[model samples]
Target: MATKEIRSWAYDELIRSPFALPQGMLGRLAGRLMLWLNDPGELVTLIGKADSVLEVGCGPGGLLRNIQAKRVCGIDPSPDMLRQAARHNRGRDVELRLGTASDTGCPDGGFDVVVSVNNVAMWPDLEAGIHELRRVTRPRGRLLIAWHSATGRSPIARKNALPEEKLARIDHALGEPTRRYELKNLTVLEKHCQR
Candidate 1:
């Protein structure tokens, strides 16, 4: 399904309802796991210095807090995730936008770094998400997509080696190199202005 539909479903499934969404020790544990999975210093190194950073699927915005960018914003499909991120950003200079990687509300070339953490593996259309990442990121800006790959398989990637179809989609989407780290299929994509 398209991102719009997925966003709508996410909004309904997570928020706007009278009942409460899932939360508790497990959620907290999972949040911590996500934080550990996406190392902070590595992100700092990747970005060099934080400027206008945008994080896609920033659940709870834990990683966003670590990066001291001039201006930081986040986009996620789920309202619950947005709410969680907002709560995490309480008293902080961070903007949480309700959207998806496929289409964020920000203007083009507005971000110095476009990073997606603990997401993308389950993206309904990964290519669309990558295109959006390429769109918002500034010239020569970086795009880091991190997913929990227990066996280094993407969980969806099955292995660091993406199949021809997936590679084709990524190639056609970002129009640049998407490298996978050793033992971690958390794909890192870079985009340049004149690519």
Candidate 2:
């Protein structure tokens, strides 16, 4: 757990902003805002079809609801968020659990695809989170890490877009042969093959 050390205090603080780590009543409000602001259609299209999918930092399960997979799973650090996700995805076959990016609680090589949206920068240790995500994905499976986009139409997305250096660090952690895609409100870093 702590193996995934915080990258730095300042970065941790920035990532753990109230909206990013929602709690209490305010957290509920933030979850509602997230549901309205973030759309998963582009991601779903990019991911295409899969037998199974795992969404880390799944927030309110918006992506989970839209993902076209026979088996969909979501993990989040906040119990409140997990509750929201469960409620939001009711009547669906989605599995919602309380977990973090560094500890997904998923079996190794169990997923065809593992994705994290709008929470890559929020990860306490980007490398450790990526490593865990990689561990759970089958060989040649896709790892999709998306965040606010620099070219986003929304000011919120533009303001929160990661700097190039930070993006490069993520690229390095994901290893070579990764591709970058700019969607309406998200910048997706897609990696294939497992180290």
Model 1: lDDT of residue 173: 71
Q: After the best TM-score superposition of candidate 2, give how far the Cα of residue 104 lies from its true spot, in angstroms.
A: 0.7
lDDT of 1 by residue, 33-135 (tens): 5545545555556656857989887876777777788898988766656777787788899989888777798898898888876466446667677777888
Alpha carbon RMSD to native, model 2: 3.6
Candidate 2: deviation at residue 18, Å?
Answer: 2.4
Q: What is the lDDT of residue 142 in candidate 2?
A: 96
Task: Itemize residue pairs with steric clashes in candidate 1.
Answer: none
- Please give, for residues 1-195, the per-residue lDDT of candidate 2 as tens digits: 111223431163534354677777777788889999887888999988899999998888888889878999999988878999999998999988888888999999999999999888877688888889999999989999998999999999999888898999999999999999999999999999654
What lDDT does each candidate get?
Answer: 0.62, 0.86
Q: What TM-score would you give candidate 2 relative to the actual structure?
A: 0.92
> Could you tell me which 10 consecutive residues in candidate 1 have the lowest summed lDDT?
1-10
Off by over 4 Å in 2: 1-16
